[model samples]
Target: MGTGAVYLTLSNLKNHPDFLTKVEIVFFCLNIILFVTNSTILLLQLVLFRQQFVRLVLDPVKGVFVPLIVLSFATIIIGIINYLVVPGHLTFEFVYVAFWIYIAFALMVCIPMLMIWFNSSHDIKTFTPAWAFLVFPLMLVGIVAINVLRVFPLLDPRAINVLLVGYIFQGLGFFVTFFYLTLYILRVMTTGFLEGHQANGAFVACGPPGFTALALIKLGEASRVILPQFGLVSETAGEVFYATAVMGSLMLLGLALFFFVFGVIPYWFKVHKHLNEILGCWALTFPNVGFVVTFRALGDVFQSQLFWTAHAVFTYSICALFVILFSLTIFAIVRGEVLFAKEKDLWADIMPEEQKRLTDNAASFGTDTVSTLDIVHLGGRKLSVDGFSEVDLEKGERRPYANI
Candidate 1:
């Protein structure tokens, strides 16, 4: 099926004039290579690290990594379909699938990252929010899959509502978690301490700005679904296309500005505070390039050279950064202790008292100091302890350090 599709894409490319087409067989060849590389890595991980993958990834209640793989596969399928079905137009089918593939690529990163984040061999049973964050992108993936497949009639109509609920909740999940991430960064910053590189990896793994940009784009699409109710526009394909394009273009612009000004710049300056700071710094590297390509849609619509040139630069730059970032992350992961120990020690510094208190308590109470407290509950409760209790106080004798 894939071979037939590739053949069709080649046939379509042959008809277009040499000057009219910027995309070549080489582009498809490169894409195939990337796909194979990612697929091979995933297969190897599932085989060699099956136990670790199950413990660190598949066993989680949220099931983030599997959803991510499903999403990536869906995006790849959709992109291949788009290339075959509508090779000329930069319309919804094309945009939808292309962005999704990039999303998959970004999330594919989290697989190995999750492995590294959960590398503590002491107790495989213990879990952390860092693990939860590692799987967050999968939530978005399930959401997008439902939305697109339903809209495109690739899925059953009865399932549409389920998909919508998935979309809404998935979106809300990202929204709620993102606030905590922001709070986390703020806490680290205010304390004049840095989080472990893995913690920073977990933060970038949450994919705040990228998800927001996608959310905004989705919101614009949702607007098109209800456009005719206002009676301000016709319910025609051309009209829908134009409106979605215009709205998406504007939202993309706003998101690009927000990403660069609010997200990228701040992150770049504070890169030292993060352990895998490069991941956070480079997370937007691909998504922002997609945003730039969205801008190039103007030329695609008009069938002109203007958009094509912009695409060339956007494609090249993003591809370069992707290669560089992937190389750096792989090196860092393999180097493990040497590369990350210094940064992991940074997280140790931030809450030294908390960690120490936990350690002391663990020795006494039989609990680790690194307990996970839900942020909401922490906000609501307030308690103060005067001092430790006496071991034997029946005669009203108090131990100095035991009770006060």
Candidate 2:
């Protein structure tokens, strides 16, 4: 999704003389390859490892990320519209149908996953801004709508419907994200920043408002064109909507900035030490892409050289961040740390013998043997070491340790 966002943002610069079409093409192909490879692996996991897949979906710490599956597809759709349909290389009719199809897929996946999270028990102290991912796909609807709207006349019925639905989606996504963010603030105030690499999740908070701002501005641009032709109210109603959208988007951009700063402060203090243990490090990429895209939108809205310069600087910064994170991810994989690490918490419910087998397999692959105590500690479970015994912090009882 992050790569696709970078590609889409660069593709939007087609009118700029310095825009390199080949760079955009490289990113487009890279995005497609990464998306397909990841999707295939996930699909295989679902098919061949159904039990483990179910466990993963129900695991408290990891389950929140399930929505990213749908969100990834949303990026693909946006990329297709912008890179293919907008260029007239692909017919609008195909992407138009794809738009609705993706909407249905996002709703079906995100809604049910949200309900699952609601029905399941979760400790509030374990909450992180990563929960914002649940609504990310829907938030992207407005972006998809704008891209789709580009191929149609401002007065076309199809464009009008897309515009109206975009507003609905934007509202749903933004307000729900607002609610989660409120809880995130409460969680942080009560529990402090999530420890270790998990602190990277804080950056996830920047994504919602950033994308919401981008969507609002783009949708507002659409309204400026479409609403005036419909005779819905005064001829200036479109202008009013556009003005209101700019104000709302600016407010959202401020909120996103707050999160971006909030996420950065921990890094400044050196709170997160394990930078490459998990793929979550990439959280730094997509969220900031939204921020940069919003900056670009404001640049376009005002034609301000300052805003455009800020946008360019940040865009290059994000590109550098992506490269750094990508290199770390590959190194971690080679070291048998991230994808190959057998996280016991994820298999806490497995049979003891099966758990041992997986643990040994991981160790055979040169992965370090991480104790259950370490895994539990990382997960923030209420357990503490008391000499040779393990004490349950919640119950204040010592239990014999089992090495498995």
Candidate 3:
């Protein structure tokens, strides 16, 4: 999804004379294909593995990511608006319908998931920046609304309605994200930085504010044009909205910069230590895309060479990071290190006898050979059949399995 956002934004850069439109289109198309393929796999998993699906949604550590499924669709929708609707290659009615449909989907996913979180017990020490994902789908609604507004005339009723809803969505998403960020700060202050690769999640904290900054500035530009036509308020009210949006966006951008720096600082000390592959490493790419794209928007807003230069530099850096991460991801896939379910992931599906048999087999092979599939519990304590490590879920001390 982050790669798609990067390509989508690059394809929309009308001001950059030297950018290769053909290359951007090619990458965007490839991203769409990948998105569709992954979506199909997830759907298939949900259908064929109902128990795993339930576990994935209810597990405290993993449940926070369920909304990212909605968010991925939101990214695709925004891309359609930018590449298809705005270009007139696709009709406005199609995307407009998609916009409302997406809103319903996002609401259904985010609201229920949030309720589950609220009702469930979680240790604060287990919290990570991934909590920001809870509201990410809602925030992207603001972004989609602004993109959809571009295809309509400023005087059009449709444009006015979109602008209004955009602000409401922005409020819900941004403020809720702020609350999550506050908790994350408290968590960090109490427990210190996340250890090892888990620290990469700090980048996730940058995303909400960075994209909100982009959405606010673009929506503000739309308000400056669209609001005065409605005669619902004084002409100066539109200016006020625009000014407020800019100021709010500036503040949010500063917040995003703090997170970006906070996320990078840990890597400075532990870059070599956490080089092992995990899907979470991809966090390095998409969150920073939000920061880079926000910089691009600021460049356009201020028409400043410095902001534009910063945008260019960051864009290239992120693209380079994307390439490196993509290669590592492919390698991990081939090595069966990611995108494959572990024994623990499917534990709920296994019969008691089958689980015991597997556990016995694992024990017979010795601790050195135990993998994630060899989970066993004695009393209330979770242990690997390998005997090398133990986890107390009540205390939230999760450790990786001894072997892949």
lDDT: which candidate is best? 2
The candidates, ranked best first by TM-score, are 3, 2, 1
After superposing all C-alphas onto the true structure, candidate 2 shows an RMSD in angstroms of 8.5
How badly does each model clash, as a count of residue pairs?
4, 0, 0
TM-score of each: 0.44, 0.82, 0.83
lDDT of 1 by residue, 1-404 (tens): 12112222232331346642334344445556656776787687567646444553545433433444443443344445445435554444553554356455645666665565446442322222244445455445533443354345323342333334445545665665555455545544555333333223322323444444444444344434533434334666335644664565555455445534444333444446422455443443433433454434444455767655655555555556555666776766775722343433333233446545543543353322332132113331111122553211112233444333
What's the C-alpha lDDT at position 368 in model 2?
51
The whole-model C-alpha lDDT of candidate 1 against the native structure comes to 0.44
49-89 per-residue lDDT for model 3 (tens digits): 87787788887777888888787787777777766776789
lDDT of 2 by residue, 337-394 (tens): 6775355545444456744653454454344554444546556432434345444433
What is candidate 2's CA lDDT for residue 226? Answer: 86
List the candidate 2 regions with Cα displacement exceeding 4 Å.
13-19, 268-271, 341-404
Q: What's model 2's lDDT at 314?
A: 75
Global lDDT of each model? 0.44, 0.75, 0.74
